[model samples]
Target: MKKIIILLLAVVAFSFKTKAQTFHVPENYTLKEKADYGKYEDDVIKGIDWLQDTPWPLEEQKRMETNVFLMKWIQGSPTVSIEINGSVAKMTEKNPQLLMTFMGGYTKYALQNKTAFDKNKANQAGVKAVIDKYVVETDHKNNSLLNKLTKIDKDGKLADWMTSDFNKTK
Candidate 1:
């Protein structure tokens, strides 16, 4: 009976350890390297997985850095943008607030870096679709992120993009 109790305790401890795991970017990693394209995609997926499994970072700087890293990755590749859209859709049920936080970050990043983001129309459309689905499927009226986004996009360009036929054909 003592041995069985010990075994159960060990299993519980192991589960806690696994659940506490968080993803961290590798040291010296560069997002600009042409040869590290595969690694970039893997890191972005891992980051999303981390967001789903772990609580968000407590530090403001850490959160902003994470957002910037993800935005850069999304901007750099259409493949990665598609992957993010699918993953975010899946995340809606499990962690919708996190998805909202991510969308808010992406929106802010795009507005601040218009030149870089404007060149990636496909990625922008994909992100817009994800946001549109999120808004429709979730109670977004009270969501602070969505509220802030509406204010930031004063010219309605982002709204226009979200309602475009691009998502309809998807």
Candidate 2:
């Protein structure tokens, strides 16, 4: 009985250690970790697609579908490099701070079949268009919150407000 109890305790302790390791995100993980995260996100996208494609197991499908939609809204670092034509377009290399917010917003808007901004309804729009729509809306309504962060002074200097806000997040 003593040996059995000891073995069970050992197993439980091992499982706890493993679970902790699985969820660990180091403060300064290497570039390889970024690539791995991107791969996992790709897998999530594919899994969502597969779940949607299946015909049977309707309840399980519905559950996974819901979970996947929520997962899509998560703001993650830009690990996935998009390819335009044959060339790799690395947004993270250029602007790491703004990548997550912009990408997440564009992704949610694009994938949700939401209506285009009210210029011309007949044309489908991409990320640039979506960002333009956001900027235009902000301009038209003079969105105070966004303006506070993004506004430029008369001398073309950036607002001091967004300097700290955009600097340390990454």
Candidate 3:
């Protein structure tokens, strides 16, 4: 009986291991044509604007991860079970902090992972074009944020500056 139980456990474990899910980046998302290029550029600008409004002591890395999942979810099948890359990825997706996590992360995602998330990369979908420009703009804003962050010495000071900057701009 013990041997049989062990065999059953092994089978279950094997099945779980074999079923471990993997990320399916849609086939070769690349930019093509005048319209696509224009939209992509616009999206990039939008992404940069979003980042400028993000709170200081910027969590750019965290934001990037969230963007990757959002892009994947949107590009992949919406009805399909969104295979979030990790527990954090799942949390970021469902996270209520849209301003910080979702928006900021999306901007990061758009800027950094443009090639992977391009509308033309896979099935030649039209939707992806909307945000392509946003992501591209993010690249510039991302660099700006990094440059500003590097210049600052203290976290508290950075946070204060970011808040002040947002208020001033707003």
Candidate 4:
């Protein structure tokens, strides 16, 4: 009985059929044009973004443990999962006050774990593009919020995630 329930749930949770559930991520990322992510990087990025937006699957309660498996389904990259799990675990525990900060942390971790975290043309250009948009929108919001975002980069620059330059207008 337990096995059957688990099996049914496994199918439900991992179902790639967008109509089967609300787990679809059609516009998962803007990383499509970025070549460093490779030919199927767009697909992998979509899968990862899906995992990010959805509620935690009850069957896969220990997300940190299942990180490797999830990574495999998303083009077989474990590094991003490892860092995401760590960031999520930390944010869930250490600093609930920093939820927004942790949100950007996970994003940066995922992006930086890619081969393009360095000062390559793809990485540098991607960072600048993302940040410019972030600054404009953030400026309309609040500078204090922006400061908090930028401060969370204490972990690492990670090629200037949105949080890194949140203080530009400050």
Ranked by lDDT, the better of candidates 2 and 3 is: 3
Clash pairs, candidate 1, are: none
| Superposed Cα deviation of residue 83, candidate 3 (Å) | 6.2
Model 2 per-residue lDDT tens digits across residues 48-140? 333223222334544444344424423343522221210002222332222332433334334344344321111112223222333433223
- TM-score of every candidate: 0.39, 0.22, 0.23, 0.27
Residue 33 CA error for candidate 2 (Å)?
Answer: 4.6
In candidate 3, what are the lDDT values of residues 34-112, reduced to their tens digit?
3443334444334333433433235555346434544443344222122222222322233223223333334434445
Q: Who wins the lDDT comparison? A: 1
Ranking by TM-score: 1, 4, 3, 2
Error of 4 at 29 (Å): 21
Candidate 4 lDDT, 1-170, residue by residue in tens: 99999999888766744522443333333232335345444444444444333334332433332233333333343333322233233323432323322333343445646554532333233333223323433223343433443454345464554333322432
Clashes of each: 0, 0, 11, 0
Question: lDDT (CA) for every model shown?
Answer: 0.50, 0.35, 0.36, 0.38
Off by over 4 Å in 1: 1-17, 57-61, 82-170
lDDT of 1 by residue, 1-170 (tens): 99999999999978745754555755566766655655665566555444433344344455556666766766664333333444334434454454544553354344445556652454454344335544444433354434443443455576454445224432
Runs in model 4 deviating more than 4 A are 1-40, 57-66, 69-89, 92-170
Better of 3 and 4 by TM-score: 4
